[model samples]
Target chain A: MDAVLEADGLGKRYGNRWALRDCTFSLPEGQVAALVGPNGAGKSTLLHLAVGLLRPDDGSVRVLGQQPYDNVAVLPDLGFVAQDTPLYRDFTAAELVTMGGKLNRARWDASVARNRLAQLGIAPHQRVGTLSGGQRAQVALALALSKRPRLLLLDEPVASLDPLARHEFLQALMGSVAETGTTVLLSSHLLSDLERVCDHLVLLETAKVRLTGSVDDLLGTHRQLIGARHDGSAIPGVAAVIRESHTDRQSTLLVRVDGWVDETRWTSTEVGLEDLILGYLGDHRRQGSHAAWGVTA
Target chain B: MVIEFVLDGRSKVNTYMQLVQQVRQALRVGLLESGDQLPKVRDVAQALAINPNTVLKAYRQLEMEGLAEGRPGVGTFVTGTLAGASLMHQAELRADLVGWLRRAQTAGLTADDIVALVDTTIRATLADDVIVVTHT
Candidate 1:
């Protein structure tokens, strides 16, 4: 599959501090990818860079095979819902749809947006400011989908909603993707939600891309192993020891494997997507980036 | 089909496997008849808030198991049924299995040891007739 988005050593800094640096990954077309990380990990920065809202200070990013910074050709094919699903509080849902139609006139499908709002029982004339958080998010999502863009970028779209609302929002998002096959990059901290809707995974830590791949492949290749305590060195046949804890008598290690492990010496168990990420994130929380420790090399 | 799939978030089982198990269960209970059309991929994805690819993967697994078949441009349909008189003995068999498990536990076998023993015995006993799918 062709990559919808690609970055190479992408970096952006604010003043003396780097918000994102040495970032690199590619999102293939037709995959709903999850952009996840700890706070201040530059998720929003990456989204902004992708949508042309901000330019990278180092290296580059490509959306639909070209630089997106002020690139009008790629803008029409890209739809973005910034954090908080922001909209004009004064305008009603209908007016917002009208504005969206005018903004993307060539590709906008008004009726689809109208039908979606109607199905959700959101009145078209209802003011955006008065709508509930979930309703506003839905309206924003409807408008984004109405544009029928080839790629959709959502930044923490469900972070503010309650669990039920989050579920409904993901349902709607998946429903639209089912129909249109629109490639989506949704940044979120909810692992369970991502497990339901996303096929691809990207983990950014301390402003760098730590891991990126298909969710199934990632889950399949990673495992949790428990065994007698051993030296904190390389284990034969294991690709990388993602994290390891040791006591005087026992060791527990989360590792990436290539269909190879010393079964006789280790009791291995498969990890779910959530645990897999938590393992990596836990390691980061303890030792910062695994890169600095050379765990991945 | 008269069945709606539900997901258990904390089950530790693969999502697609949960879906497949649900289908098998519905078939075992006679809720999904041989001719019944499975839910559309889009419908399932929307209803369950899961990726369409996951739903497609589950349906493909069903097809592989000879329990269902998909028609181009249409949807998947059940083609096999596991419902039989054996289901009538489920209660009795379950009681005996529970008793055996309790006995094994009391006799100093850990859960994993009992599972391995039962699994191996089952394989040794039904080697030619069954394909064992051990769940953790």
Candidate 2:
């Protein structure tokens, strides 16, 4: 099967400013991928392009083996919950679900939506405007899941939710993915949340992709070395120096390893997901350039 | 069955590694034994709110380490034990070790110092065995 989402040289511009430029990444099917980046790094722009909310100015994007926009068959297979989870304020939970069923036609599963709402403790008669933020988000998620989408694109769905609510929402989401094998591409600035749920990662910065890969593979290939740092010129297997800091007596280097290094020289420690992401983000910020650390593209 | 998996997301340790370590630790403490079925991947994933793939990877790692095995259409099961001694013997040894650790703590040894001491002792014993073999 092709990737769930694929982008090649994807770029999007607004007037003179480039919201996203030269972005390219392929998210494999059945993987929960975390799309993370700093504010204004085009995270949302990339997601918008993927879901066909906006078109790319330069390159092309494919969602589930077809162009996202204007494709009759593809639209039903793609579910999108925008950042605010835009829902009709006056519509009750049941009405919103009915609307979803009407909008999706044969594709919508009203029973699934209604059951999810009831399980989430959302009363069917309650107006969306009167629901709590978490309840509203749950209703939005129910609508999305009711479509039975093969690919679900979430944009900071839990950014405003409290910790417990966030946990509950993710629990529900993962349950659906497990049951239905839904491919999730969730964009969030919260690294901790991503760390818990994401097996794949894509890091964006300055409107470009800094890194993307399986989290396990990335963590296995990166190492933190704290020892006498002497320019790192003699390190034979260092793929890239992701980040480097020095003191008068010692040097710390975060390096992507392509092969074995002389372990006797430094204490090599394992790198975690958050540390790896922060290292790339910090490097991009300090250098103000897209230095692809371990990213071939 | 129904292993209560705990994950420390904030720790520097990789989550999968943490899972692998937990399974091994459980075996060592007799909490899990041979023929004990591990939770289904989806069940653990939903319970922890983590990706099912992560749970699958951890289970695969355990299988690689010869600690677990996955039966087709059936759930994964613990296949090997980490503890070398009999359960009664292990309990006695554990009690002695705990008593020794308490004494070491009372003697102003930090947790790091205790770990270092245990690690160095094990390494030194292995080195002695190697020297003995070479001389023989």
Candidate 3:
């Protein structure tokens, strides 16, 4: 299956520091995938590369089966909505959506845009700056939807909306994608939203892909085993210890083991998405202990 | 058609799941039954001040679980059954209970304590009158 978006050895640098380094992942067509990372983990950089907004210092990116930079063909089929949701502050919601139609070659239906805006309860004539944060997000979404693109890229699209509006926007976005079979790459800080909407995930930390796979597979492979640490030398095959809670009698460990736990060795338990993220972040912290301790390498 | 929904800000559950669970709870309590039409995704989004996507997700989950169906030209409506199987409904619920039991075990709660908690909670909930808000 051809990926709607693919990154090959993607890296970005600013001066001597790498915002993102050696990152590579691909998003399949017609599926929703999320890029998750802490601040400055290069989620934006990766998103930019995916959308062709920024060229990578190393490697390449393909959007809709073609290179994104200077590629007009991909532009018509892809819609990139940035985190800030850039808009003409002076223009009304309707006016800005109309302007988008004029600026982009992709055919946009004015009535559809109007209906979507009205559905969001955002007045079409209301100035962009005058709308509430949630309403502004709705207008931005309306603009993206109006484009009728086959591939949708959203960065922190629901960051500013209230709980209710966030749900509404995501539902509409999902429905639109479902209806058009649009491949969507959405980045958000909220894991629960992604959990509900996305089947695939890319876990990023330290400017690299820490783990990438379907959510089910990732969860299936990682588990927490509670048992007595009988011997101090080593726990046979546990690759890394995420966390440990112990007493004189029993020791429980959260480990990222490659295989299943033998029931006799320890009681195995499933870990939630949040637990996985905590473990991944803990790994990054341990690996970067030098930076934490302020040692300039 | 007017779409009615209830928002509970107190629950620890994520807002999106809370909304979906509320719709499901409503269904369980007979507030929304088969053939009942849901409000437009946007309307519920706007009225509740949530992102449309979140509501869409709830609706999507509802649709996936067979609680709702989305008709492209018209709108989403309550479905006849949850995914499938009328006879296995109680069995599925029991499986969910077992999953919760495992979680409770992880938390160091005994089976007796779990049963007591459930009984008490069920009794308390049965004591309260249903709160239904109809919006047009």
Error of 3 at A156 (Å): 1.4
Q: Pick the candidate with the highest TM-score.
A: 1
Per-prediction TM-score to the true structure, in the order listed: 0.85, 0.84, 0.69
> Candidate 3 DockQ category?
incorrect
Residue A92 local lDDT, model 1? 93
> Candidate 3, TM-score vs. the true structure?
0.69
lDDT of 3 at B30: 56
**lDDT per residue as tens, model 1, B1-136:** 4678899977878889999999999889777879999988888899999999999999999999999999988999999998898877877898999999999999999999998998889888897578766769
DockQ of all predictions against the true structure, Cα-based = 0.64, 0.57, 0.07
Query: Clashing residue pairs in candidate 1, if any?
Result: none
Q: How far does residue A140 in candidate 1 sit from its true spot (Å)? A: 0.4
Model 3: residues >4 Å from true position, as ranges? A230-250, A256-259, A286-297, B1-136
Regions of model 1 farther than 4 Å from truth = A287-297, B85-136
lDDT of 1 by residue, A122-158 (tens): 8888999999999999999999999899999999999
| Best of the candidates, lDDT | 1
Tens digits of per-residue lDDT, candidate 2, B9-111, equal 6566666778899999899888999999998887788788888877888999999999999998888999999976677588788899999999999999999
